[model samples]
Target: MPVTEPIRVGRDTKEELRRLKVHPRETYDDVIRRLIDVYRKCQQ
Candidate 1:
């Protein structure tokens, strides 16, 4: 099994994550992972 962790964010940041979702059913983890992938590509 994989271990999970929690992190805190401001209300505005939470709202921004929701807005970035590709679909209503998408998970925040997916959104964050996608953002991380983009950031990695940009740094290359």
Candidate 2:
């Protein structure tokens, strides 16, 4: 398994991420990747 490091976020920030998730079970990595894809599409 790949090593993972802990990341810290403020309470409000964490809440925002929870709301942004497509599904309750989605990981933070998935949410971030999806946001990046949307941003790249907008930039084009």
Candidate 3:
């Protein structure tokens, strides 16, 4: 089994991630992964 870790973020940062979500129920992990992919594409 994979180990999961807890992370803490500021309320404002959480709100920002909420806004970045593609769907209402999208997880923060998905949102950050999508953002990282986009950034990597731009850097290439």
The alpha-carbon RMSD values of the candidates against the true structure, listed in the order shown, are 1.3, 1.3, 1.5
Best by TM-score: 1
Candidate 2 residue lDDT tens string, 1-44? 86777899999988988999989999887897899999999999
lDDT of each: 0.95, 0.90, 0.93
* Greater-TM-score candidate between 2 and 3: 3
Looking at model 3, report the run of 10 residues with the lowest lDDT sum: 1-10
List model 1 lDDT by residue over 1-44, tens digit each.
76678989899999999999999999888999999999999999
Candidate 3, 1-44: lDDT as tens digits? 75767899999999999999989999898898899999999999
Off by over 4 Å in 2: none
The estimated TM-scores of all candidates read: 0.88, 0.77, 0.82
Which of the numbered candidates is closest to the native, going by highest lDDT? Answer: 1
By lDDT, the candidates rank as 1, 3, 2
Indicate the residue-level lDDT of 39 in model 1: 100
Q: Which stretches of candidate 1 lie over 4 Å from their true place?
A: none
